[model samples]
Target: MDGPPATPPAPKAPTLGNALHRFANPGRFMRLSGALLPWLAAAGLALSVTGLAWGLVFAPRDWQQGDTVRIMFIHVPAAWMAMGGYVGLAVASFIGLVWRHPLADIAAREIAPVGAVFTAICLITGSLWGKPMWGTWWVWDARLTSVLVLFFLYVGHIALSNAFDDPERAARPAAILALIGAVNLPIIKFSVDWWNTLHQPASVTRLGAPGIHVDILQPLLVTGLGFLFVFAALALLRTRTGILERRARALMAARAAEPAATPSAVAV
Candidate 1:
């Protein structure tokens, strides 16, 4: 008889990459996010508070717009994040479509609503500022119209993503839409120059210098950073909530499938 076949060596213990694989599963993700939630919340709160106080109180008023310019603290940051978030979602959607990472679809799904909300806030706040500054509540200008299209794109993304019962099926078409809409981003940025619109020329970046003075720049930076932190915190929290919800549903289904074994198992 031949000698007993030798067993293969056990695989090396899993690393962080493996942990990430496991984390992609909803249950493990929920645990990790639960642990991280408090820290994220604290950071968001601190950043928002500091930014608001410094921006509203300490930052010098603009020479051109004066007190009316204060709205920039909210409007500019929201506008930036609105565009930034779509780019992020589109990237995540691409990953989901190509690599099929489990968390990628979840990310894409959650980010749409957040992006839409920010876009809406930007539009509203911008309108409020524009009415006084531009002498109109709304204009059919290129910048404004492109931003409107962006808002509608966000709405379409969120609605389409949830329209299907099968998560995998929903992900595929939604991912395609996100990728396509990403093309609109550069269009939005250049629309002001492409057409003579009411929106002002780029003040933050032009030629070799920023037009805004240091005093205004300082609070703008603070508010921008604060908005970034808040975005991160919200995204994390929303993704975690989605993971937990899916896990809980799966657990409930699993429990339902498990038989009771007639009360005798309980008696024993």
Candidate 2:
């Protein structure tokens, strides 16, 4: 007989990949999102109202831009979300392409339209602010041009994602497009520094001290948080809708494929 039994190996630690894999189950995600939806909606609405009111009414006016600077409350958050949304989309696309996660594919598809809307909002608000400050409705600046390309990429992704009758066939091409489009993101972020541009350089995110004053920065941060919450809530809603729609379609297809009963069987 052996003197002692062999020791067992230690269990492996959980990782990000394993955590993400847990959400691959549509039922689990639906349950989780349903539970969180109300809280997300309430927080998003409350924070947005508070932030907008604080920034628009209570914050001190900018010395240079005056009241027009208040546009920052909306424009800055929209721009941030536009960029952030694409990042989320690209990550989802990568997951879907590599792991073939159905939820990831749904996430990638659902995020495109939301990201496009945010990009549009950013452009419109920037134009509105520019008319007053820059004395023009639009400019072909590097930052602006890159962002415009981003918007177009979003539109293309949405179209490509839905082009095929079979969604499984659709997912791969859209994921590839999303990955290719991700190149524009870094260009959009660094456009101001890499080349001359009409757009202002970084204010809050710079390496040295922030260029903006505390009074303005506080509301900006708050508003940004509110926008982020809103995006999260909307994304969750869309993803859940997608999952339900897919399930419904699958059920319908299953019913359609069943063989019809013979006349004798029906009569009996």
Candidate 3:
């Protein structure tokens, strides 16, 4: 009797999750990022220098703010980076939680400290910019409070990620914390409209066209893009270093365990 031919199984459908899975291999990620890093670093440096120089030397001074307006090049871009970096962290955390992707886990770990630095830069620069304009260095304003909370969230994530000797045990909880803290992002962005705060309303990112003049706007945009590129380059660099560190740790642990598994010889 002739047997019926078996049907071949259907191929898996393409998807974002499936696409991201390719980055799970550390070797592949390392090779690709190594090639990409130099370009990002150079672009970031050139753009940042051009923007700061244009803003500081060429941009017309605000009739109201006078020379203090120059600080916008640094302060505004920093605030943007702080919030943007946190969003990236939350996304990486989601990828880590949902897929248990090792690279995502490593990325989440590396991003926290860099995000924290951006948050701190925003706070410090905000204070300095405020001291001259607002007449005080500190305020309990809604936007400021929300941003401070964000800084704490970054600190908490860093603390949690390194709390245990075994990182796998800590990964899920830290990821969950990042997701929870993302609730504050909307609060930070909308704080001006949500409440009467000391901080000004949206200037660059308004639903309507931007309120600022082109002279100020151009430099601001360049600096903002520059900060984003630098942040990406830094995060990728840290992730590559992390992958190498993990490899070293694994080799050392394996060697440490090797001797205990061997039997000792007895002399006759």
Candidate 4:
């Protein structure tokens, strides 16, 4: 019987709130992810399958692009997510720095590689598409240049974040870097107008409406949603893995610190 009676065990740790505050308990994080992963996995599979079916089989070939139009479903979404992921990283990094949310840092760290992959895919595929359409493998246009900057930014974040010995110290500078790079995204979006570039003007977003027709648009939209879900699922899985790895390292360090106990029970 202590003086304060142990402070009521901290009110049972509030699962619903803990769900929102995921980094509060590693066990809760594991449980929530375990429950959610299956659904995300299922939905991702279903969407990709359905979207591929529509895009490849049912959707009409573009009169101009022909079979190459199929590539747009993948290319456009990869480009969108590449930019989207970087913005997410910057936001998460900012939250981690300002609020000191551990989960936010993990999210930022885990997402960068995925974003980099998407950015590379977007660039390569765009180049491939451009070769046939524009008669060149690469161009010095504004859109392409901005995307190249994005790629280098991702590389810089990855390299700089790991350069420091202390994780916290590394995280802060990396966060700042992410914020600085985020400004390039808007430049990437508006580059066609601000500067004369070989890259085409906005086709997807226009004052009147989308330039593309419904038949192609439906597949494009479907694939985009599929890609979005896939990104979410992958991000969650990677973040969870990072959390577990950190916990394991902590436990190992704790074990190393404590003295080894002698075996007392009889054994065969």
Candidate 4 per-residue lDDT over residues 27-86, each given as its tens digit: 776788778887887787788778878888888888988887877877888898999999
Tell me the tens digit of each residue's lDDT in model 3 across 190-251. Answer: 99999999999999998788999999999999999999998999999998988888898899
Candidate 1 residue-wise lDDT, 35-152, digit = tens: 8878877776787677777778988887889887888888888888899999989988987887687587888888888899989999999999999898999999888899899999
Ranking by TM-score: 3, 2, 4, 1
Local distance difference test, candidate 1: 0.83
* lDDT values for all models: 0.83, 0.92, 0.92, 0.83
Q: After best superposition, candidate 1 residue 207: deviation in angstroms?
A: 5.0
User: Which residue pairs in model 1 clash with each other?
Assistant: none
How do the predictions measure up, each by TM-score? 0.84, 0.93, 0.94, 0.85
lDDT for 96 in candidate 2 is 92
The residue ranges of model 4 lying beyond 4 angstroms of the native Cα positions read 1-26, 260-268
Model 1 / residue 79 / CA error / Å: 0.7
Superposition error at 46 for model 2 (Å):
0.9
**Model 3, global lDDT:** 0.92
Instruction: Name the better of 2 and 4 by TM-score.
Output: 2
Best by TM-score: 3
